[model samples]
Target: MKKITTPLKEKDIRALKAGEEVLLKGVIYTARDQAHKRLCDLIKKRRQLPFALKNQIIYYCGPTPAPPGKIIGSCGPTTSSRMDKFTIPLLKNGLKGMIGKGKRSAEIISAIKKYKAIYFLAPAGAGAYLSKFVKKKELISWPELGTEAIFRLEVEDFPLIVGIDIKGRSIYDKR
Candidate 1:
């Protein structure tokens, strides 16, 4: 498996292929459905975002509250397709990568190729297990939205698979 860090570089993204295993490290931002909508809305109005999208990776997740002494809790990936409508706008704005579960639409695949981006698949039903990789968590925005709020997480060697590569290749396409 290839080991990679955050704010993914073009060389790193291009070297990856669909179905390849990866260990991702560094910072990733969490943004669920609500956060996505908010971000897209901001893009529409040409307003400044809470964070810049350039070369950034957004994980589709809404982590549960941390218990006793953990950095995070049940931090699993959400379905990627739900954000399909909001995705292209972010990609257009320079978002480079995404981590989530399940397949993406054909248009999204086409867009991924056009924008030179990649999509990663995290383990499903492994929320509790995945929490072990999160080293730190800081609220980024919309705390009132609770779990759906945006969060910045520092991770180390978090496991993932390339669900869709920059060439528009997809593991789901095999079926």
Candidate 2:
């Protein structure tokens, strides 16, 4: 297995083919629909974002509340398709990669090709297992959005797979 980090540079993610196991490290952001829409709004207004998007990875997850003495609560990838509308704009604004579960839309695939970006998927139904990898968590913005709030998570050896590539390839695509 290879070790990968984000915001993913073009060369690194482009080099990742489908059917590969990877362990991820570094700071990754967590967001869902509301957070994504907010981010797009911020970008459109040319306002500063809570975190840097360049060379960073955005994980689509809405984790459960952590119990006392825990970094996070059942942190797993959410359904990726829901974020399809927000993704293209982020990618256009220098967002390099994404992490989540399930399939995405054809428009997202086309954007991936246009931007030379990558999409990774963590295991489904494995939130409890994945939470162990998050070493720390910081809520960056939109706390009022509840679980959809943007968060910065520092992860170590977070397990994942290359679900989509720059060539508009996706592992979830039925052959």
Top candidate (lDDT): 1
| Model 2 C-alpha lDDT per residue in residues 1-175, reported as the tens digit of each score | 7998765777788789866789999989999988988898998899998887877889999999889999999988889998998898788878888999888898898898898888888999899999999999999988898889998999999999988888888887766
> What residue pairs are clashing in model 1?
none
lDDT of 2: 0.88
lDDT of each: 0.95, 0.88
Top TM-score prediction, candidate number: 1
Write down the worst ten-residue block by lDDT for model 2: 5-14
Q: lDDT value for candidate 1?
A: 0.95
Model 1 stretches astray by more than 4 angstroms: none
